[model samples]
Target chain A: MVWNEKAECMSREEKEKLQIKLLKEAIEKAYNNVPFYKKRFDEAGVGPEDLQSLEDIEKFPFTTKADLRETYPFGMFAVPEDEIVEIHSTSGTTGKPTVSGYTKKDLDIWAEVTARAIDMAGGTKKDRIQNCYGYGLFTGGLGIHHGGYKLGATVIPISAGNTKRQIEIMKDFQSTILTCTPSYALYLAESIEKEGISIEELGLKSGIFGAEMWTEEMRDELENRLGITAVNIYGLTELMGPGVANECMVKKGLHIADDHFYPEIIDSKTKETLPEGEKGELVLTTLTREGMPVIRFRTKDITSLNYDKCDCGRTTVRMSRITGRTDDMLKVRGVIVFPSQIERAILKIEGLTPNYQIIVTRPEYLDEIEVQVEATPSLFSDEMKEMEAIERKIANKIHKEIGLRVNVSLVESESLPRSEGKAVRVIDKRNFD
Target chain B: MKIQQISVFIENKEGRLKKAIDVLSKAGINIRALSIADTSKFGILRLIVSDNKKAKEALESNKFVVKENDVLVVEIPDHPDGLNTILGYLDDDKINVEYIYAFVSNKTDEAIVVMKLENIEEGMKALKEHNAKILTLEDIKNL
Candidate 1:
């Protein structure tokens, strides 16, 4: 009942004054209670008194993923386990899973932020949302679920799988809005067509897709198929999951909730902060997080920032679509590639299954990549010559997409492994010891 | 009849294969039968062509790593004895057969045999004396 569009649209001065007050309180609480921050401040030769404004906030040391790893699970937690009502964690693909806890008040604030995200993407209480994000340790599902409830929408709480049943319920429940990763949305679209279901008649209106980067070309494709607007939502488990920012109707960069979470862009390698409009890594400091207050937490996502007011009413600073992660990018044959680029290229080619793998190996002392792509029955025939031609076409298109040539092998459709959770895009064999 | 066969060494890189194809495309050399023997390193590209001489010259003139090797193409009846008859000669001659693949036959009642041999001239002599139909480039191309 308390969607604050007016507060969201407030002038910069008004928001800054409020942000400063919240930031001060949050910093004070962290310095007093959190041992990690207490030691960091002691080593920096600074105290809570050094932070008069946001400028002095930089004197604080930056926290890296390694720091979270060092602490393991819940070592940085500001409150006891009993006071913490909820816990969320990273997927742990890279190493040990990093966990964060949230008190009841923390959950309330998180829900409010997510509600703001839903509202900006044009959701209403009358809408029925089919939430398709993965649940459990992964924060995407529960994070969006809490927000959808706070917004008073009829949330289906259908965590990510069973596409048949999901599509079935979309029609049965007349679900108006959908939330999931862009990869899964396209998967659902394929299912809808295969089952001879009418997506247009389902009364589905809009979608919010995140957890992975997608392209404008993919957006156009999904929009054409589903006849609905697909917006981008961005967040990470370390940063409190899928409501840190969202795209408004303007379809510009995602608007960050700067009042609650102050965002800064810094050079990933140098660790030096960059000015607005410059592309760099994102760093966030939670101004109002209760249980797990993070200060200058380095988020390796590579993107530019937009401070100019958007056509949409929100005055919060907007961040561009993440081009690539500093660590997620791969250097093959002197060419830098992000997995998202491959997804974009595959999506552009109609009748090509999105399930594919990038197998990187050092064969004969040179970096080589073979893209094992799956062929839809409609796009290929059993004839070896036909398969060869399709393979050539895919290789050529991929060359155009990433500016690097890749060996494309056409495998049987659905032969490539499908992920129940996040799809593995690249397998690097660089021999990292 | 003769069956044209051509072999080229391909570096294991992304666009190298495309460049090779582009070279063949520009030269008007139509590939009849092709296979790649890939290792962890570079691949050996083997092809049985409609015009072996033309493919060889086209590939060579373009500075492609090309070679002409005598790989025996022996005809066998489309029955079980087809393999035994060919292997009997090779086994007697003490010539090692590296690998073998059967080709679709253009002939009415026989299939074509392609084999890599350690001693090419010795194997050819044995096949000829054994009344084996030694397939020429054109013979394999037509079949």
Candidate 2:
């Protein structure tokens, strides 16, 4: 198995001290290497000496999504293009996509980190893993694939779609482990039941699902349906994809590969680091990336940190399941509403489904929120009055939960578009420009 | 005879159509026939309704992005040649049909063709010259 000497047995105090050392090293690297970072640092009138302790970390300017946008394709890479072995990017709904790169050493380290994550999730070399995440520029598939291979598992690269074929490969290979998004996993389980394939008949045992937000209720449902344990994996294209963290068999929270990537929670507004267990924005600093070394990269994902030791015997700190995104938070009428909160409200409704849209429009001056929910087949009926009543009920529930009144529209099931990649959650038409 | 034609701009998202329907229903308007012209991001819902003024007011008040426009409505035979005859008339004059939609009237044994034209006045004249019936606003509402 791929293992790092420094991470495996390091004490908590040693890890913390090591992180401070690395943060200073990363700041100096940015100051001396990248022109963009240099300009920002010079303009801020800050030097390496200013970063004496973690308290001074707030002195650095917080990087925004706009900064990533300003750089565009590969402008932020600290190393030369010739040194970069691979390039990955996230798609753009508004403008050009944010690009990232990896050197050969970086890829190797990523594979090692992923392997460690797989081990944390209770996978052994004896298990045959079926990976359904998409590859190419997308990180999910290749990230998990490299990790599974490193762990010496027979990896089946069934990268997204064709659920039937995925099932066939799983059964034929007697695959014991699966790695894909939670949505796709649910879809696969539903398809298996529809096809009358018993879960017991397939030797599948465990799964690692990520790349989109899911709830605890969803995890329970998936576990019950797939007849296996499901673990949550976390990462982004900007931070080297799915291996930045993984949940242990305990499934309490995702364990961060804290040795390679330092994790900190920060107040989204003030950019101040919060104490552990306080809900805030996740900030990551890569200690040992080669191609594009990042220093204090602000990942807009909102979650808290857990330093409690796990029963699995790993000393790495864990992160709670992502509640939502700092950017994804919808500010309407001076109220901060997350789409996930609406999703939670909708999921609690007996006949409502997960497919929905949060539309924010500026008809007058203030922003108005409208939730268009898709009614499951069970909720659809011949009676028009019943459907209207259901809509009213849903609207009332949303109002009660979020403390904001919203217009609710009950759309037919499958009426909402399905995404093959990241699901588009919010549609803001408030003239953001 | 006055008929109201309304165009609504919509995105390909859930609840949009239902919201439109809700707005129209609240205004006590009945849609005679409707067509959706869709691209990826936005869709235009064009409707011929019994209460056009009410429908337009309700849509605008509810903040639905909409526009009002006029298109020539022509009555045609129910048979296949009904459309070919109209196209044949326009083709001879070198006038092109940009887009079109239709609703067949069961009792009347006729269909209505709502056509957008390159030249509206000339296109209507060419159709009238061919002895085809150009539907008035009253003709559409009665159906």
Candidate 3:
């Protein structure tokens, strides 16, 4: 099922030799075309010739999401605007969205990597892919779309939402491969169940879920519910969308497409490279991207790399599931809690994409956390006994996640928003002023 | 016989009850009996209205978390011992009355009691043997 044996399964010695060559070419491309990278390279006292080995990547300045934003529209593109063929962007909830421009060559590379991902997920030409990721500007839909096209699989371009129709297409089209956010997959499963459609009624064999943090427990839930092998796909718009790394059938860890993008782990604060298996921020360099050659971009995602050979037979280094981001971790009553932990706790409860938001407020001398869970129509009850039991159940799950007692309130379902990458569900109302 | 009742969730805050009442009023749902079980955290407002479907649709359209459950509406004398008498029969049968709320009928001297019993089947048998007058949805609408 490996798409390209030479690239995916090459020997480590040969790989590193190839990496050194591609790294040098990418550095020279970035320095020559991008004034931002040139200034960064000059300020850091590092030049293209200095990148002699993979280890020399340490000398290069780390490009960040902030740095990418500073470049704005076309500042990061190594190719001229006429040559750039496509653009995909992050949701940019906090500030201006980071734009990723791709040349025809860059897109072909995206197709190959994603095709490798789909192949890794047990997809092939005979498979029909029901791509549920949004098709617009987000890389998710089009990424899977292009991969399916390259793999010669029939791609159903049904984008996100319209739950009823999603299930209808899932049944009528007899889709065998599914792709979307992990939360949305859960939501679709619950919706299908509500429609009284059995797993035997559909043809789903595997799924590619990503775009947010998810847990192994949630993975089990999705696999069991949809009766499909759920694989995790990892990428950001800063990188070339969702083909950077993906989990193979062995499900050990996500295999980073080592030949295309180089992966590194470093202390987020100190900027020092950590040894393999030591957890830190994930730093990536687009070694082969032509339109935009990112040099050591600090992704801010917390994970570790494993160079050990995978049972799936790909020599590419695999990274553990993203636990959290350094920038999004929250401190509640001095105890560090990631929104992913809360999401992990929330997933324990039934109904797709549990609608719960953590409300942090300091009423007295202490900070208190109250999680507001929406009482959806499927879970709501007319009796207080049943409704309160649901609340207490969510509260107990939250307590187990973070060893602290917090309030649980069942609010009207309308107040809570449906998260699809429904970013920022935590509300920090505590004021320091 | 059991009748359907609408239960609406109300947070412990000002003007929530008024908003819920306004929804039903604008829908022109004539409420037969109404009661509020209050806690410091929140309250549950239970009601027997002229139309259960209309009232629920109205409340839900206004963004209220409304639910429907079955409860018994019984007719008794408008005296203290009337409720005591009905309770003694259920107590003899060991059926627990989870909650009970009463409304005085304008058409008669009898008081209507809405009771939610944990052992509903047992409570129904006991009440029937004791000759308790259980109201139907139509009887509730008339009351």
Candidate 4:
């Protein structure tokens, strides 16, 4: 069920050769058309002609989110305004969002990579795709929709929210493939039971989940609850939506579309590309994008690259699951801790709900963190001693997980806020800005 | 008799107890007996109100989590040794009281206390053997 088998199954040498040629064109296009890339390239004294081999990419300047933010609203488009057909943007927390434009051919390539993503999730033309990723302004919805259509599957553009309607349509349409964020998938799994709908009633073989960071424990929960193979799909609005990489059934790591998106791991602080298997920040270059060809864009997401061939028969380089973001990595009492690590610890223990919030504050000279986890009905006790014991158990578990002690508070049931999209779990009051 | 008490789960935030009280007050329900057990994180505010149904609805409408628990309601002498005398009966009967809170009954010169015992049925039996007067829901409504 491999989509674009020739491109996806190419040998390492062939793929590298293709990537080198595409990189030259992308660099030349970015230099010739986009003034931002041109000025930045000129200042670095690196021209398109300087790109002789793949190794020459190291000499080029790295583009960042701030750089993209500077060019808001059509400033980064490499193609003519009329040539650009589609546009998607991320919800920028700081006032204005970063926009991405795509030409018709660029849309075709988006569909192609998403098609490969759907194929990686074991979806085919016979499969019915119930896409709940969200449709407008965000790349998740339409990006996966394009892939479903390209894969020739029945794409149910159900969009997001409307939990009841989502389930009703899922059962009626007999959708075989589910696509949404991993958190949303988990919500649906829980909702299915609340609605009295058994897992066997709907035909869901696999789910392509991404758009937020989720742990392996969550994946296991989704897989068990939905009775399907839960796979991870990685993509950002800047990098052609959610078709950038996908996890095959092998469940090891996500295989990046090597020829389309040239992937590299780099030390975020040093800005130098790290060798294979070394964990660092991910930097991606859109080798074949026409509308907005990004040149070595620094994706603040933290992950590692595995160049080894996968058992799923794809030679595309795979990236380990994103562990933490360099920006969100918390330094508490000189100890580095990721919310994901704390989350892993919380989920590992029984009688604890997934809804939790981390509050970091600087009291005097020391930084303190309080992890507040919602107490489900089963976890709640009327006695103070029993409830305090629950809090202590969670705190000890977190200390063991992150190597840093934190105050654990067992808040009332359903006290924390629930998000339909990305959940904001951290409230940093350290005032470091 | 076993009286139904409403246990409200509240965060240890300022005005939380007042918020629950406000809800019950706005509903025109009279609170009979109340006790709060809390840690630094959260508190469980237990209440015996004129209308358990109405009080629960009011607090829950305000998005408070409420649990219905059973506890023995008995009348004791309204004196310095009243609470101690009731506990002596439980001790002599080998019964365990988890928590006990008292509210003066308007109908008499006695205090009606809510006893959250480890075994409600056994507590009622022991209190009955000691000739302690236990109040029912109807008696609580009248008071």
Among the numbered candidates, top DockQ falls to 3
Regions more than 4 Å wrong, model 4: A49-52, A186-203, A224-227, B1-6, B13-32, B39-41, B48-63, B68-80, B89-96, B106-110, B117-143
Specify the poorest-scoring 10-residue window by lDDT in model 1 chain A: A377-386
lDDT per residue (tens digit) for residues A127-193 in model 2: 8888888977888889988898888888888898887799899888898988888877877886798
Q: Using TM-score as the measure, which candidate wins?
A: 4
Residue A232, model 1: Cα distance from true site in angstroms? 1.3
| Residue A262, candidate 4: C-alpha displacement in angstroms | 0.9
| Best of the two (1, 4) by TM-score | 4
In model 1, which regions exceed 4 Å deviation?
A381-389, B1-143
lDDT for each residue of candidate 4 in B14-101, tens digit (9 for 90 to 100): 8888888998999999987888887666788988888889887787667677778898888988789988888998998888888888
lDDT of every predicted structure (CA atoms): 0.79, 0.79, 0.87, 0.88
User: What is the lDDT, from 0 to 100, of the residue A351 in candidate 3?
Assistant: 56
lDDT by residue (tens digit), candidate 1, A1-433: 2267665778888887887788788788888988888888899887888888877777888888888888878778888779999998997888988988899998988898888888887898988988999878898899889999999988998999999899899888988888998878878887788678887669888999888877887788888788788899988777688899988878999989888899889998888889989999999999888898888889889998988888876788899989889888899878889877887787778776567899898877788878877544355432234445776788888888889888886543454566545667788877856
Sort by DockQ, best first. 3, 4, 1, 2
Worst 10 residues of 2 chain B by lDDT: B1-10
Ten consecutive residues with minimal summed lDDT in candidate 4 chain A? A375-384
- A1-433 in candidate 4: lDDT tens per residue? 6787788788999998999999999999999999999999999998999999998999999998888889998899997899988889998875579999999999999999999999999998999999998889999999999999998999999999998899999999999999988777877886798678999999999999998888898787788889999999999888889989999999999999888899999999899889999999999999999999998999999999998888978888999999999988999999999998998988887867677899999998899999998766566666666677877888888999888889988766556876667778899999876
Task: Give residue A270's lDDT in candidate 3 (0 to 100).
Answer: 93
What DockQ values do the models have?
0.02, 0.02, 0.41, 0.37
The interface RMSD values of the models, given in order, are 14.4, 13.0, 2.0, 1.9
Residue A253 miss distance in model 3 (angstroms): 2.3
